[model samples]
Target: DTAVSQTPKYLVTQMGNDKSIKCEQNLGHDTMYWYKQDSKKFLKIMFSYNNKELIINETVPNRFSPKSPDKAHLNLHINSLELGDSAVYFCASSHLQTQSPSSNYGYTFGSGTRLTVV
Candidate 1:
């Protein structure tokens, strides 16, 4: 079974539209995250949900929101989308534990949803 999964792997929308992407993980992890990959392939985490608590990156715009209905899911919602928002969004999950060489619990990322705004 897939450890992590996302729906609607591709999205094409017009400016000023609203959209949402759903993500679910079966790794039994306590922490899940949303990362945005720009056209340059630069990855930057936007929001993180730890055990259903939302922790958003300060740099992220208020228009973007992360909703964790449960520990195994983190869904992203974008309102009044803009062209600048066009990018590949990735959903990832990781064990909620201290990281060490012997206890490394790395992140498992979804296939990614490529969003385009015209």
Candidate 2:
């Protein structure tokens, strides 16, 4: 079973349209994050949720919004999507416990949703 999964693996839409990407994690993690990877493969953190509380919201455009109904789900909604918004959106989850050599501090990432705005 996939620890993290995202729906609509590929999305294609027009420039003025709106779109959403759904994500879910079954790892029972306390924190989730949304990251955008541009054409150059630079990953940027867009938003982060810790136990349903908003934290680490980056300087993304206001057109992008993240909603989390619970600790296991985090959805990204974009309004008036633009060509620049085309990228791979990734959903990741991790436990926020104290760091230790045996502890899993790395994030569990989804396959990624590739959005294309034409």
Candidate 3:
């Protein structure tokens, strides 16, 4: 089973349009995050939810909102989308962090949703 999944793998819309993307995870993790990958492939965290509470990234515009109905699900809504909003969005899940030289900083990420604003 996929640890994390996101819908509408590809999206193309005109500027000023509104759209939404949905995400879910079955890993039973309490923490989930949204990341945006710009054209240059710079990844930045947009939002995070821990046990259904929102932790917004202050740098993110108010046009973007994240909602978590429960620990296993998180969804994003964007309003007044701009041309600069074109990018790939990814959803990821992680639980406990164990620091060991051999242990991978554990995280499972979903296939990204590519959004293009024209």
Candidate with best lDDT:
1
Cα displacement (Å) at residue 66, model 3: 0.3
lDDT (10s digit) by residue, model 2, range 49-78: 887367655578889988898889999999
Query: Per model, how many backbone clashes are there?
Result: 0, 0, 0
How much lDDT does candidate 2 score?
0.91
Candidate 2: where is the Cα deviation over 4 Å? 97-104
Ranking by lDDT, best first? 1, 2, 3
By TM-score rank, best first, the candidates go: 1, 2, 3
* Candidate 3 C-alpha lDDT tens digits along 1-118: 9889999899999999999999999999888899999999999999888874677888999999988888899899999999999999999988744466465456789999999999
Which residue pairs of candidate 1 clash? none
Residue lDDT tens for model 1, 40-73: 9999999888974677899999999888889999
Q: What is the model-wide C-alpha lDDT for candidate 1?
A: 0.92
